[model samples]
Target: MRFDIPLPDDTARLEALAHLDGLVKPVGSLGRVEELAAWLAAAHGSMPPRPLDDVRVVVFAGDHGVSDPAGPHGAVSAYPREVTASMVRVFLAGTSGVTVLARQVGARVRVLDIAVDGELADVPAEVTAHKIRRGSGSIDVTDALAPGEAERALAAGMAVADAEIDAGADLLIPGDMGIGNSTVAATLVAAVLGLPAEDVVGTGTGVNEAGRARKVAAVRAALARTADRASDPLSTFTALGSACAAATAGFVLRAAERRTPVLLDGVFSCAAALVCAELAPEAPRWWLAGHRSTEPSQAFALKALGLTPLLDLGLRLGEGSGAVQAVPLLRSAQAVISEMGLLADLA
Candidate 1:
């Protein structure tokens, strides 16, 4: 509740726009580039908007018990449950797409083992155990977490944000690495937006026809269990969302509280962004949609958040890879804002 959210400052926005008008070009030649510069100014509540030079991508890795459990459990992912931990190790080893992308963006990567099912053995120093639990309860059958699990997960995320900000990370990207998380995000989107599960569910991780059908059913069940209270952030998160979702929500909330901008990645972080929106209402002031995930619910999440993503290359990989891909654009937005000369100066 202490998101202590900042309001978008029109004065800062106007100041940025004024500067943009002075630049050496047609008044609006840069188009959305000018709009983005103003938004950065508004988000920071500063006229010149501090540069996003220290972008950090923090990925919350967890495992879900709802994953492709054997037999009657059905498949929520095309890959096995082992895939979550496998990808976490991949992230830790610096070979994952997100790791490679983060390097390309000149951003530091922090992979946290929040709640992977099996313990991550000998994780790198950059990877730490912020484990809220080994794995979340299956949402299709029952509440995915206990009454207080959402708060704990959220607190863990806030702590992560504080540490990163204290250490001088100016921009943050919150990513998720749980295999079955898209299902939960779909359920969250449906429940929060008051839509049918079918409207928000998507075939995550390239599931087959049968697997996609099973995923839809899981989302419906999870939404049914949530009932009302979708507007209640903690209750909604505990009932139908995963720990990684709650943690990502917390991370976003903390970033907004500190007025540090966030690049939210994919559907998983969208669900978390929804949680922050429900709780703080003004949190989106400090956030931007990094990409539109291939997940169907991601579109709904983006619409609900009123965010137009920076890219949409049909990215479905969710290790913060898509979000990191947009950092260069943020840098570009800053560059065009700060470096372009006035027409008089150009002459």
Candidate 2:
């Protein structure tokens, strides 16, 4: 997969900086908020970006065989695999963490069952339209997806992004919902960054010490098995990531290609961003780290991408909760840029 993503507009960013300095405040009073305003302006290719009126958060749901209770290594997450489907229902019912926060920020939430292991009943057809498989292969012992399945998942993600942008979404947040996804995400990060398992593994979903050890072993095994493919982002993801993650990578890459800003949430999205950066080195220009997740892999990925996060709330809940929380802050920055008076006007 090839993407010729153009960097965000530099002229607009410089102009935004100058505008911020001219505002009725000290030159550096706003600190990071000013930086956020300039990034929005640059991403939108305007001095002051239009309000984030139609923000959309797309949650890519899936299942991982490595999390199977019957698998050789047993479950890696605190929650069972069935929770993936149950959370999908919760998201559809508009009661999940992301949904609740999205409402607060006036953003819409879309949940896609990309690789859910079980069939969801009584749900809208669009949610499962992009389903790649029941569950991804157990990455510790087998490839996460066949090459064809990986490509299809990526295409599905790109299509979803296009639809959202076409529907007038001003900002996008890519969320994730999958049991045992933390293991998959950590593995991908370890492989891409050439780090050891302990460096990236964490207590995903509040796993115990033994569970964390299991996750570390799984990540180490996955990295060793996929070592040769580490140089190729798609190949690495195909081996160590779930279909949902592949879709997330595709979604991020396409968003950057369209010059749309994306607020990345948690470790899964951070891992996906790493893969996208490998595919298109300039993709991070249109992306922002919504928060610093509790996952160590997220910190590693952010450092690698050279992007500082906006918040460090110790949030580990996936499904875009942290990003949704950060939405209001971005809007506040936009207000300062668009509505604040200039010092000259005060004179």
Candidate 3:
């Protein structure tokens, strides 16, 4: 679905500001929440804005070519491609905790396949296939994805966001699932935030001490291999990131253009956010950092982006689970702005 996000009308914004001024509260008493509500009202071309009731979480799943490298942090031994397809299946079956929490909060979860290899058997009806390539190119020795493939993955993400908005979704959560994605994510963070690979690489999906060391080494090697390329941010993604990272970056840009808020997941999601911020600096205003991960690199990325995480429960899971869990808190923030009576009125 093609969508053209309209800018806020001047008349509508003026009316919203007037309504906010006349509300039963001290001027600027509710602080940033009130400003956010007013901004939403203006974005919708309305006064006294209504709550954004519909929320959809779009999880993009793919595979990383870096998984085949001769490193200790390579793909887990128990499962290979099956793990990617299997976890997606679990999500579609509503058996995963993320699905449970989303259902509890009345949010719809949509899974998108961007670059997984092979066809999924008995695919659930909710999963949408938007594959750009069978899988990304190997980043251990070559570019992660072709430049054209990077654009295609980005367009695929924007397409999903457009479709969800047409179906009445006013807020979006872009999640990711791909084994060995932390390698790509770490590379992206290092390139954008100007940090060394050691500061941005971390143990993803519960890697142990030895595995963590291996992961860090793999990232450093990749960074060293790509040090001389003077490419732009998009080139950085195509060179060293996965489809999930590229798509998530596009989703954030599209969401910001539409003035819709986005809930971000962990390191991968934050990597995407950093890319989106590079593409459009104002995009950060529409983002809410969901949680801080147990991964040290995630903390560094968050700090570099100047974000204060809403929760820090030692979460290291990166399948949008942490972000989904924080949805209620976002709603509560909105509620405080929309429903609370002002102290001045009470007095």
C-alpha root-mean-square deviation, candidate 3:
3.7
Q: Which model scores highest in lDDT? A: 2
Off by over 4 Å in 1: 71-73, 124-128, 228-231
lDDT of 3 at 304: 70
As for lDDT, the candidate ahead, 1 or 3, is: 1
TM-score of each candidate structure, all chains considered together: 0.95, 0.98, 0.85
Candidate 1 lDDT by residue in tens digits, 232-344: 78888888887888899989999998888899999899888986799988898789999889888889889988999999989998878898998888778778887888777
Error of 2 at 28 (Å): 1.0
- Mark the 10 consecutive residues where model 1 has the least summed lDDT: 222-231
With a 3 Å backbone cut-off (N, CA, C), the pairs that clash in candidate 3 are none
Q: Provide the clashing-pair count of each candidate structure.
A: 0, 0, 0
Model 1 superposed RMSD (Cα) = 1.7
Q: Which stretches of candidate 2 lie over 4 Å from their true place?
A: 228-230
- lDDT order of candidates, top first: 2, 1, 3
Candidate 3, overall lDDT? 0.73
Residues 1-347, model 3: lDDT tens digits? 23344455567657655656656777776565555566556655655555668978888888877775454346522236557777888888887767887888888888777877656767854464677766776676678888687787778787787788878887788888887777778878887777886677666776666666666777777777788988666787788887778888888778877777777888888987887677676677667788888766677777777787878888876778888887776666456545665445755
Model 2 local distance difference test score: 0.91
